[model samples]
Target: MSQVSEKAVSFEPEEKKEKKEWKINVFAMLLVLLVIAAVITHILPAGKYEQIEKNGYTTVDPNSFKWIASTPLGFFDTVKSIPTGMVEAANIIFFILIIGGFFGVLKASGTVEALVSTMAKKLANREKLMIPIIMLFFALGGSLMGMAEEALVYVPLFIPLALAVGFDTITGTAMVLVGASVGFTTAIMNPFTVGLAQGIAGLPMYSGMGFRLVLFVVIYVIAVTFVYRHAMKVKRDPASGIYGKFDTNEQDSLLTAKVELTKRHKWILTAFLINYIILVFGVIKYEWYIKEIAALFIILTIIIAILGKISLDDTVESFTQGSASLIGGALIIGVSRAILVVLNQGHIIDPLLYQVSEEMKHVSPFLSVVGMYNFQVAIHFILASGSGHAMLTMPIMAPLADLLDITRQTAVLSFSFADGIGNIIFPTGGTLMAGLAIAGISWTRWARWILPLILIEYSIGLIAVIIAHLIGYGPS
Candidate 1:
């Protein structure tokens, strides 16, 4: 099965506009939320501060001046974050190379294409509910593939199918986001997010797969429900128009991305799989870190390029092109990090966290963490990207969980839910951008359809965590 034919992705114009409009709305909401948060923090009553200090919370020294003293340090703070930026740049480049190799091998061997085509044939007749089916397909894909980028190959095929079935482009784009987030947030298999979070929190790798799988199903159902409701609404009221005018010329076109892979592409895929298998074993036995895994990827890229009989120049060209495709996303990530640094430098993260943490302390020790967990959930709405927010805030949060007599696992789970839910509204997310662009949907349209669903699911997730705490699933 050829990869392209196996999956029917539609890159139609209507979906793209819906995504654009949704993004615009999300950006506006995020800005307003940030401003309101800032104003509230600025006007915090001194009595609350006194009560907070009485509760043993670490008080931010108003006269200590780290926040105000470094007013001009914002420029250099970005410079300092350059190392992180470089690391991110490298990660993006390597990810593209790895993805290209995997796709190339699958396409050349006809495995991916065959699978997609076979699946499509079975699904074509069920096309009336195509959005939900595609959402399920990508959710499974994300779990099995263990990589969100894998969706990039098939989103194009799904968009057109969506349009053909009388749904607009926004519905198509939303499907991809729903699937990716469900799989990503609750993935029992993906080593990227789950692995990093566990490793950092000093938990055993893959120890919590069962717990995560449960989350996966819940998130999937929530995502599907939200998407279905919005799609139905759009169908019922076309004049209520849940989309913006799509810019059909958005650069993430699948047509331009397709390239022919030679026979050796099969060997490269084999090599890639074998390499990862070895990596899994190595991590299990030797406690390898990300840098080690990265080294393995670099070595495999070089070896596969040679075995495929591709010239170094051609290999480099392909790799460069792949890297270039990700540059836009990479830049956005860096800028977002810069904004984070600004927020942190302003001493805002801790103060707000302290406020929430203090409130949680008054509750039962076992359930006190729920409030803090919910706080993260709220923060997720503003900082919708996952790793970006997690890496920035979890370190501070993990310790607070311990101090508050909360289970770290519970804290991690809450972070996961928040991180996952945040993506539903954040317009700056790469997956959302790519999915919308391909479908020709605008951000405003997407927000109109998906925001309510995001809120509902987030609410449900909080309830679930609360239930988990009540049932003695958490530590006191």
Candidate 2:
């Protein structure tokens, strides 16, 4: 939900850890679901709905639902549907690639490193203030800019810094993980989750910023409070903290803290900030969609590369490398899209939707929102990639919301909060695992530490979705 770059999950038969591991590979999981969707087509009656686009948003005529001949996808068709799904989802896939490249160029220019160093230094002496301040910094990054994977690098950097200041590694690790997740849960302008979901739901990009901003502050405070309490506990009694088997001897080249914030770095960050402002204005005032947002990122990449004084060859290489890194994420989007393709071709989606409509019609509106929120939270364990989850679910959920008389924006918000909050507890989350690996904390330990907060945040997400539904959050 936060970062669009996906790292391939390593699922090699762990001869040693097989007895311990309980996770399924995301690719294998998606493929299995694709097959299941195909199988469902043969079992259920086929149906269709005539779609009509009004005011740029598309919706199905509920009364226009009709039976259609079943056209089940064969094995070859199902496999072929994967690439076709990519084609259908190309707009979102490319948007991720461009953002990856944009961030890559920024990374190559040493801007992010400088930014991190500057922040760490600014909070160096404020031992009591460190947890809240750094946590808020990351929360803002995630809510406004979608900073998940990028925040992973902070784990090692902050663990030692946190230890030196009398706090434990978990305290430092929680700052980034919890902070970024809180912002993600209350996403205001995050392109990957909220942006893509809104696009699919046919809502204006980054609309409803006001409510999200308020939620962001509330979540930020909650996250900071949790981390601060734990950090102080550890500060007072080191033995009370669960360090696991963390390797205190682990070292990194960046640990020396020599990355200087040069004037050029400041300018680059300023340009980065300005680009986001432009993106907000363009979307709000000019009605920019995916294409316009993508174009702005491309332009910003070029501008940042030039300002960073990166050589022409290096800039091109950086862009290529960045785009290449996100290939897995891009493919996940397309692969998830294929599931929809198979469902649509089988003519089963409409029937499924019809059933859902009937099933939800009698349910209380508030309970229905809560049910949707809980469903997203449960599903996030398997589909941890925020964009991938959006691609797989939004197309269906958007229309389903229309039938339930719930705003599609509410649906999008539900997905956002569900996917974002689940990441902190989901063992399958790569960034979570990576951060813990850096801190030398085990999954068991991390889960035990964060489970309470996870439940609290889950409740918050449910409330947010219910409120959104009551208020009719939407452009439609």
Best by lDDT: 2
lDDT of 1: 0.53
The count of residue-pair clashes in candidate 1 stands at 50
Q: Candidate 2's residue-wise lDDT over 73-168, tens digit each?
A: 888999898999889877766876676577668777876655654555665557788778888888877777677765654554566556545566
Which clashing pairs does model 2 show? Answer: 1-386
Q: Give RMSD to native, each candidate.
A: 8.3, 7.7
For model 2, the stretches where C-alpha displacement exceeds 4 angstroms are 1-22, 125-255, 360-455, 460-476
Alpha-carbon error at 57 in model 2, in Å?
A: 1.5
Model 1 lDDT per residue over 1-476, tens place:
32333232322234232222214433344344434444443454322112113122223332222222222234445455434533544544344334444333333344333333333345544745676677887776555334454455455445433443434456666687678777766656555554555555556665556666777777787778777776666556654433333222211122333434445655665776798677657665675544566576667767766776667676676555544434443444443333344354445655565566657756786567567667777776445455545554455556666777666666667777776666656653545544554444555656656778777767766776675555534322
Q: What are the lDDT figures for the candidates, one per model?
A: 0.53, 0.71
Hey, what RMSD does candidate 2 come out at? 7.7
Q: Give the candidate number with the greatest TM-score.
A: 2
Native-vs-model 2 lDDT? 0.71
Per-residue lDDT, model 2, residue 402, is 80
